[model samples]
Target chain A: MIEPIVGRYVTIEVQGVTQRIYFEEAGQGRPILCLHTAGADTRQWRHLMNDSEVTKANRLIAFDMPWHSKSLPPEGFQTQEYLLTTETYIETVLGMVTALGLDRPVLAGCSMGGRIALQLAALHPDKFNGFIAIEASDFQPAWYDIDWFDRPDAHGGEMGAALVSANISPFAPEAERWNTLWMFMQSGPGVFRGDLSFYTRDDSLIARLGQIDTAKTPVHLIVGAYDLTCTPEDAKRTADAIPGATLSVMAEVGHFPMSEHPDGFRPFFIEALGKMPEPAA
Target chain B: MRSTLQTMQARLNASDHLKHLGRLFSETVLIEVDGDEFYLTFEKGAMVSLDAGPSRKTPSRFALRTDADALQKFWQSRPAPGFHDIFGLVKIGRGRIDGDMLLLVKNMRFFKEFMALGRVKAGADQ
Candidate 1:
């Protein structure tokens, strides 16, 4: 049987560079722009796209960040090192929204994506109707040395997969766990480290949390119980900082909630979506 | 601990994947469980020696130290969160690593698989 998800590409200008970004979407109605984690592709949203509960009334769209998966790096990428900064990341997401002509879509992101979602809430609250930040926080210190992820002596693929494997809960089905690892194994060389540049190096957004007008754009968070990197406490801290924000600490799951346990992640997402103000007709 | 280490060594050596993963790695690793020490020396991925004692003679490149209770929890087939992974143990203050962190991170995949052998043995024993 053919899958409901449809994949395509779009040409957009981001940070003064022309990029052909790859994206996948399923279903229709109010748009929900999904963002993937560091070094991961849009495939992380596959299960959500296929779920009837999510698709019946909402459109699910996910895009791979440049230098990740099918979203190839722009011209002259080889001339210098690839490092993700908040400015460039914000430009990319805004570029996608403009290129696709999404009308105030709800922004949903995980990890690095989740951080950006919060940033958007502060920087451009009216851009979307709501936000869903999964396994994200305002400030997170680097747990592992980024250099080890892309050294010549180590197999970057295996090392990346092994290090991040702990982010997934042991309770997840074996197949789902391995499937999630497969994406990390397939990640481009140095890409994981490059993505961590934004994740580990970014300044704390805690001071800026007060700027988020949640009354205009509601903020929702769902973190995993077993995630040591972005612990439930981290999500709570972010949630508590924002008035009218909702938070849920999921049990028996870890960092990659959507990929590692889609069945478990669905209810939280559905409830969050339900709470969001409906888009104008 | 001695018998379990023996079983783990045997299991690791028998796996071709582990052999390939560790082919370029060679180091002497110290494992300390509640002050009880066991030294495992590897040459090109094959475990050449497994010694049990508190010897100041053979120096180790790195060491993994955890209490017996934590080690037991980590070895379970369905280990609880914070015990399910080596890094998780470190994050939760249940385990500690000392010396040459780069060496351990360089061969992280191999080291993780090496430690996971205990899980296999534990499952079999059950």
Candidate 2:
């Protein structure tokens, strides 16, 4: 059985700008705040949001970042030079958590979102109850070049998708595959690349991972076996860097696990989310 | 067609990634378009020169062979699953890289960016 999901817009002033962010919510119980991948939006968690079992015991919330998916840019914000810095990204997430008044909400994020999740847990140790990270690493290989994004095709459609096409394994379901693929295809020029500015270059955790007390804020790292961008070895290295962080490698799926292979990723998702102490009353 | 590719040399040399990479590996890559060849000699990540046929001082490390249509489509930012990337094109039997496999593997992304310059330029062409 699955639960009906509701979508809504949140108005929050972040970094001195008023942003109308888009988010979705379903079910009720302990709150599980989900962050989506880079170059993507809240749709990544649609499967989890729809799952009856997940929504039954927990309140699931997912949001689209400014300039991503259905979320629009702040008025007067230059759309061309769009860049998401580490500081701004953190601030936005914190803004969402605070606006919702969620106490120690469990956080789950994938890829760009996943890296942010780990960083959020590490930076604000007491803010989160637990975290489920998917397809994330402190640093990724540089060869996955994205300079093509600086100059886009007639519509900036194709190259962005090509940059990570192989990351989606053939084993993924047809709908799942297209769902993930179309996100990249439809992205505005430089949107995906701007997001990568953080994913590949800006987000640094080597000096900070040691600061994360995994005992206090439980960290569950779930990665795909076929993720070329951030290999399993990379996840292992990241897990090794963090104290007491547990790692689970999902088979066959690649970078976009939540959207690409939710069924395969569900068990780990359940195990990790189920362990989080219920949200404060 | 060579003009389009030849134009990308400056963009590649100007790249922070390539400029930084050029400082690391001083190698030559031979790009064969149709039957014609252009040897891109790099010192560090900077392209010292583009020579048609062959060069006297430096020898190429590997040769990447692709046809005009494939290269043009790639340069158009067509996206992957098309012939947009070296590996993607290789998968479809549209292109091949011969010579030092390790060198190609070592600087895979660097070469990817280098090739993408043409595509970038194509995208920039209004």
Candidate 3:
């Protein structure tokens, strides 16, 4: 019988803000930050953290992003008044890394987290040993055009409510439904809408990606063949833009491939991490 | 009476697989509408209400309901050519369709047969 892998919460100070970051740390060797998708916390990477490959080769640090589960948003932060910019998110992540004294950790993110990973790599290439993004894409034009700040209660609007309800299904166990619903509700409407706006805004990181000094570090992109949220075409385009970036399309998977199809993705993830180029002398 | 009439009407609505429609009455069929929080069971041609809790019993056949408008369109074009083309538009989430997905590829006749029965529709295809 296999024992279940459990995670714990730790509080780390970012700048002046003391935020709680939930993480699952295991194994030894090179450090790697496993970032989760939007509306999801570190739990999404539970399978990866416990996988034999990760446990043997790298030290996995899975954490909840700010304004997400177990992590508190900065004080006086107004979701309706302030837009959640990708730059702000990257800065916070950098703060956490610096505060913890982590050595050039390899960065990995899924979906929205993936977008942040790309931004971090481009903005602060010196801080990371390598980067990996799953189902990440450039922001669509429609995202920035919408003004979610104008409506304070827009988070609880019909579409938001419907999405919330759909996420928790009757097929899931009662406990699972309760936990998932609680996270969605606690994340609140403004934060949710703000994040969506941040994601949809047209910020083409594609052109900026090639400028990253990948000669010293490696970059990888993993996508699902059936990812409805971000298609393989988008992943191909991103790969084409980034110099020497490798793209792997997993079979029979979707947006949350880490959870939906871990078995098929573990080997590829391990292979990519193993191939990370040695730091420039 | 009106509610019962509606239920009967919904059940009576002819599926392309009326020939094997009898199978629906004999075997248990689970219809999971992924988008909606609705999972229905049809046994002996009648709907059965199960407790809203987790159970060990899995369904024999699963049908995903994509949307109401697409369902209406398919219903209107009954006996229309190229019914299997509907699967192209329909999106399937994380559920198994009972019949052989390969047969649909290898033999177009079997494909048409499965689509004609309208036993299962992908959530996106509805």
- Superposition error at B4 for model 2 (Å): 31
The TM-score obtained by model 1 is 0.96
Model 2: colliding residue pairs:
A162-B80, B22-B44, B22-B45, B23-B44, B23-B45
lDDT of 2 by residue, A1-281 (tens): 43488988889988887889998899888889999887878888889889988889989999999988788877875635777888888889889999888888898988888888888888986888988888888877455455556562233444556556657654577689778878877776678878888887864776788888887888888887657677688899989998899998877677888798888778888988866666555
Q: What is the DockQ of each candidate?
A: 0.72, 0.04, 0.04
Candidate 1 C-alpha lDDT tens digits along B13-105: 898899899998889999998899999999899888999869999799999999888988888887777898888889889899988988887
Worst-scoring 10-residue span by lDDT in model 1 chain A: A149-158
Q: How many residue pairs clash in each candidate?
A: 0, 5, 6
Candidate 1, residues A1-281, lDDT tens digits: the string is 89999999999998789999999999899999999999788988999999987898999999999999999988988876888999989999999999899999999999999999999999988789899999989988797788777877776767888888888886777898888988888988889998998999987577888898888999999899888789998899999999889998888899998899888888888988987878998
Q: After superposition, how far is residue B89 of candidate 2 from its true place, in Å?
A: 12
- Per-residue accuracy of model 3 over B1-126 as CA lDDT, tens digit each: 223223533543444343243332433333333343233344433345422313346543434334444434433322121111334224232233443322222222222233333333334443
Model 2 agreement with the true structure over B47-93: per-residue lDDT tens digits: 78787875455578898988988887777643433354576566567
Clashing pairs in 3: A143-A200, B17-B117, B66-B123, B90-B124, B90-B125, B91-B124
Predicted model with the maximum TM-score: 1
Judged by DockQ relative to the true structure, which candidate is superior, 1 or 2? 1
Query: What are the per-residue Cα lDDT tens digits for candidate 3 across A1-281?
Result: 65345556667665466666665667676878888776667766767877766777677787777777766666776632435677667866787677657788889888888888888878888899999988887654441123432245333332332233222212233454344434444564456666666777738576688776667667889886655457678888887887888899775455666654566667878877876754444
